[model samples]
Target chain A: MDQRPPDHITAAPSLAAKPPIVTLDGVSKAYANGTVALRDVNLSIGRAQFVSLLGPSGCGKSTLLRLIAGLGDLTGGRIDWPGSAKASDGTPKRDLGFVFQEPTLMPWANVFDNVYLPLKLGRLSRKQARPRIMDALAMVGLEKFERSYPRELSGGMKMRVSIARALITRPSVLLMDEPFAALDEITRFRLNDDLLRLWAGRDWTVIFVTHSVYESVYLSNRIVVMGARPGRITADLAIDAPYPRSEAFRMIPAYNEYCRMVSAELHATMGEASPE
Target chain B: MSTSAEPVAQRADRRLIALRIALPILVGVVFLGTWQILVTWLQVPKFVLPAPSLIATAFVDDFASLMGSLWFTLTVTVEAFILAVVGGVALAVLFSQSEIVATALFPYAVILQVTPVVSIAPLIIIWVGYDNVRVALLILAWIVAFFPVLSNTTLGLRSTDHNLRNLMQLYGASRWRILTEVQFPSALPYLLAGMKISGGLSLIGAVVAEFVAGSGASTGLAWRIIEAGNRLDIPRMFAALALLSVLGIAIFGVLSAFEYLMLRHWHESAVRREN
Candidate 1:
């Protein structure tokens, strides 16, 4: 396992003073077959922060996110959701929502039903969740297609339904694993814009995982660069760009500079490898 | 899949549906006409090859007896089919809920499937008692019909999307809720597919079992075929055979329609793409 400490690009003095919403201290995950997916990753995400776990393939970015979501067990160390309230299901994790890389909508379920899943599992009645489900659908611009099944929707629309499903419960922490990676650029950009709009002016923590530097830079305030071959964090840097970050933000030099920095850091992280 | 030319699409869809029904019927009429004309033109013997008209007449003459046999055969077929569905689905669910149970018993299920029911029909008939041939027939038919549903439903249950399972787990859904809401529904198309196969097999099983039991064992269509064959009443035999074919077609049609109804909304097999 790679034991080197993560090199912070800026040391993040701005975030150092604030209390973290989640703290990952030396969180390590090794499979039973002896493959180390992650190792000694320390991360403290502040409340409402948009953090991106960015890396090349096999970097365990996804594994880290899953560990944080309580979807998988860590073989070493621990994760703590500090000050989190116990969800109605009796887990502190219910205050969280997860969006997989795939849209992951139930193929048998229509739009309204797919969005209704999270709440439905919480034992909320369909009648009780109707308005909220509609609200979530409208937020994703799919109010007219409630009866449509996942097979009927375009890839982008399916992802929108997935997003709606994730947001229906209004969880404090939203974990998205490259949610827009499979979409076309036009769709991806539109979804990126939609996601940023939703994240704006709300106290929601979103830990997004992506291999795309531009995506990580555009969507997240802080990007944690990771390395493969016993996946470990290599660098952490803050975007520090102002919000309501518009398309015009993409055209600006500072945005390009941040992207270039992230790209270089990511490329460097990709360089050190014990070949498989 | 809906297009802006809604009326045109609707008309085309209607035409397609009409063609599906009409083409088969038109072919059947032409086939019968040719068969009748050739038989009459060639002076074929009545016993050698009866024309469609002679078969029709024989059908009319034996209507009461044929209907009684059909009803009996259908009862056994339907009863066996229902038992197979219940047994298969129940066994599959039990297997899915416990790995140890599945591991211990799945090989025996495979063994039952591989061993031909025809080979065992007489043995089963003897074992169940010659006096209770109907119970024997039911047992043989259920054995023949239940495996497909069992295997297919098990596969469907196992094939539940990993991501969906994780999503449900993340939501903290009860195991029962996950089984009913996700696994059961996911398994429906597979179960239905298996049932369609089983529907036909159950009929065959009932007939095969009755055939082995021989004359006086039951008043089923298979028995009528056997009885007619013994007397060289070829036309009556033809009539019984025709009825059996019709019954088979009807069973398939009903099961296909039911499958379409259950799956037309979401399953890929049932959904029609305009493109």
Candidate 2:
């Protein structure tokens, strides 16, 4: 609440002006073995913001994403879904969809069935959910391969199926944990475009976890850079670069400038706590 | 040249299929011919070693009784196999319900698996009442067949992908929904493998239990084999033994076909790679 947030919560001056959808107050997670995965992570994300939690390995970016999605319990502090978007459970995290590092698909099921799972679990009938499933798959460009099994699909295709599945419920928030890390560069770039295209003009919030700073700068409007060794946010950046960013943007000077700024902020934080 | 090339490829494909079928039959024919010639030339006694020709005659001669015995054996085997499939899968589902339950019950299944069926056949017959000998045969066969299904299915259920389970959890799926939608389908390949193994064990159980239970209470192929051996009717024994082999192979074939059909879409073992 200070006029200037303590040095750790640097950046995000523009974020503080917008109404926050989610607020984390002194959130901390510690395992039973006495390892503090995250410590006192104070942050707020506005509605429809594509916020990237970017850090190197062991930075607790993944843990932070999991906690926000309600997949894991935080040992201390709390997270609040402050917007009117509190899904029926009084927390949007329960209703938020997730895309893991792996496609994490049920191999036995076809593309249609895989995409249909969350709806099916919610007790929606196949006939009723067919249109939504098809729409989700088509949005990811996989409608024609609805009958294809996960085994038959390539790595990028599998990730697309995973994206389709995550969006099938039309969740207000989607959490992606390094979803495109395993993909080839060409495939990753295409998927990044496809993902941006999907998130554009939508009201959904996406919290993406990534180790790559360029990925963070390219994909997210707001980047919350964190550091390892009792993980906490070191900087919160708002990439002011305009949308409809394409291959041309990657070659532009402004994009490079933003990446360099995020990169320096990231390295500065990593240098302080990192053992190496 | 392209038109001719297609026909050439089709003809070669047909020849490959023909060879697969013909090769095994060729080996069987050669072995049987050698046996027949040796038996006839050496003037071997039919009581000591029945030639393939003599076995054939006995097959024709006792065709009526053999048919009856075959039907009875097949009936018991099928009944036991069906019971094993249902009971094993059901128990596996129950075991998968709780880790404590699986731990508590798994040892008994292992005991049944390890303790030879032959050792327990007489006891099962006695316990079920000697008059309920057919029921005894069914239970013994079921025990042998059920273990694989129960063990394999539980393994499959346990090995459901961790991330997928987490995904289901995130979606607010209930225990039942997770089991039916994710757990069961994931365990299917393992379940099918168990069924194939159990199918053969069912027949073995029926025959072995009958052998121990003695020939009096039933008229299955096992009873036929014992009766022929006691009378030194070796040709009839060979005929019964042949039926048993054929029956075992048939059950394996059916189960394998079912497995392929179920898993060809996704399972690595069942899919045709070249295609």
Model 1: per-residue Cα lDDT over A191-261, one tens digit each: 99999999999998899999998988888888889999989999888788889887999999878777777
Badly placed stretches (over 4 Å) of model 1 are A1-9, A86-93, A272-276, B1-4
**Residue B153 Cα positional deviation in candidate 2, in Å, after optimal superposition:** 0.8
lDDT of 1 by residue, B174-255 (tens): 8888898789989999999999999999999999989989959699999999998888888899999999999999999999
Q: Best candidate per DockQ, number?
A: 2
Considering the two chains of model 2, state its CAPRI-style docking category.
high
lDDT of 1: 0.90
Number of colliding residue pairs in model 1: 0
Q: How far is candidate 1 from the true structure (C-alpha RMSD, Å)?
A: 3.7
Local error of candidate 1 at B21, Å? 2.4
Chain B TM-scores of the candidates = 0.96, 0.95
Error in Å for residue A109 of model 1: 1.4
The TM-score obtained for chain B of candidate 2 when compared with the true chain B: 0.95
